[model samples]
Target: MFLNTWSLWEKEPDYNSYLGLAENLDEKGYAVSFGDNPFDDDKVGEKVYMHILNRADKYVHIITPYLILDDGLLMALKYFAERGIDTKLILPGIPDKKAVYALAETYFRTLLNSGVEIYLYTPGFVHAKVFVSDDKKAVVGTINLDYRSLYHHFESGTYLYGAKCITDIEADYQATLSKCEKVTYESIKKEKAFVKLRGRFMRLIAPLL
Candidate 1:
């Protein structure tokens, strides 16, 4: 089932779709959560994502155009990496927004050091938001890895467990990986001061973005 989150800033905040979807998943014994208000700690997108990430056993593959990781999400990914899980992120090689890309780069070194493999998709821009885990669970929706997405935006994604498309999702992930350029600490460290400052500023105010 497809779920959608429409924020009040963009339209009206309608989380009925997500709430209903979560209910369905819950009945099937799949851990799920959804919230319309970002101010409420428990009823927010990040909480839902954290539950999913924490449940991942073997691998977690994420494909997103943006890569602005919040502290909690970053910690979850770091934990998975430290546990020897295959945690991978596929981002855009040529970004649609340079400022966002720069801000995302600021975390590359830290994430790399934590053992999270990062890939930059070549050929064209990667605009999909997908999460696949351990061949049994997946999430496909509009959740970006930025503070705006996790906090301000009323985003929605389908929480799938043993879905038929799981295999196809993994296949797509591998195919996309083939078109990516692996990111390294050395490559992201040579940025100019002004660029770094701008990125840092963007990262600082990501929630307001």
Candidate 2:
């Protein structure tokens, strides 16, 4: 059964609900959040990475128009691979911002090495901020992997457990996979350091950039 595609940000997830997932996971010894504000050091050694990793359920479907592999998210992804999670990352192939695209590549290499599959949505901007784990839970809204979306933007997302919506989200993620290029560690290491540095600089002001 295929569920029709719907816009993520346009759909908009409830703010409190997204944060609730974080708190709930924390109680269960997992910590993840929707927005940035990484002030809770003891609780959140990593940012919203638990949003991706703490799911030992089925699969993790992530849709972010823009993405970067910061330390927090990176560590969570590494953990996901160790546990053999069916990891799928869907990002934008036709990048609107050249610098951000470069930075994403840097993260792509790291993610690929950790056994996390990468997918790039080429139809458009692919700016849907959402994540679904094993069809049981899903988050969709405006959050991203960059520091800005996490630390700045007042983002929102949803966690749905229904059948119709879950199927559609999975289908879209799989569809985008067909359009993505598989990244490798070799390619990442071979990338130009100068370009990578430029991307990092951009990340420094990613919220405003």
Candidate 3:
């Protein structure tokens, strides 16, 4: 498995893309025992979604421009860390939107200190949403795991089987880390007043914004 062969999407947030995938999976059913919560409505069900994170025992890969991991997300990640699951985060060092990028630093700092690893990508904007667990399944598509993406705007990702595509995604993550800087709480403390203030503000509205 090149790591990426497991899952793939030709386009980002292709509506029919995820809908089609859901139909296929529905038809295919589960050869192995599985748990799924269909997102009929727009809002992301926090409890169920977070639970999935806590239960993932294999490998978990999440790709997004920003990682404002809620407490549940953090707890699940901590679980992954304690058990020594292969955990990696794909993040962007630079973002197309200046405001979000500035605030993202704080979230990055928090996660890095908490033991979740981060990888920054300097190449343009990264708008891919992908979460792959182990060599078995992956979700790739237009939705981001952020407040706006998950709740406000509609989003979708198709779960896939196999390993090659996933392997490639992992490889890309690793290669990105080499070009990226690792964040730490200590480093966060070294941030300028504006950055610090921005982080403070972001946290205040963290849940809704």
Number of the top lDDT candidate: 1
How does each model score on TM-score?
0.80, 0.68, 0.67
List, residue by residue over 1-209, the lDDT tens digit for candidate 1. Answer: 44343221233223345556545543332323234457666445565466657777899999988887767888889888989989999999999998988898888888888899999997868989888888977777778877777777777766666666787899999999999999987777677888889899998877676
Better of 1 and 3 by lDDT: 1
| lDDT for model 2 | 0.61
Residue range 1-209, candidate 2, lDDT tens digits? 11222222323234344434444332222212233234532222122336445744667877777776567677887778767888878778688987888767766766777788876665657777777777656656566766666664455444454435666777777777787765656657787889889877876765564
Model 1, residue 191: C-alpha shift (Å): 3.3
Clashes of 3: 17
Which model, 1 or 2, shows the larger lDDT?
1
The reply for model 3, stretches above 4 Å from the true place, is 1-52
Candidate 2, TM-score vs. the true structure?
0.68
Badly placed stretches (over 4 Å) of model 2 are 1-52, 185-194, 200-209
Model 2, position 69: C-alpha lDDT score: 55
Give me the displacement of residue 92 in model 2, in angstroms.
Answer: 1.1
Residue-level lDDT tens digits of model 3 in 3-75: 1111222222233344244454433322211222234452433332443355466767777776555666667
Task: Give the Å error, residue 57, model 2.
Answer: 2.5
- What's the lDDT for residue 103 in model 1? 92
Between candidates 2 and 3, name the one with more favorable lDDT.
2
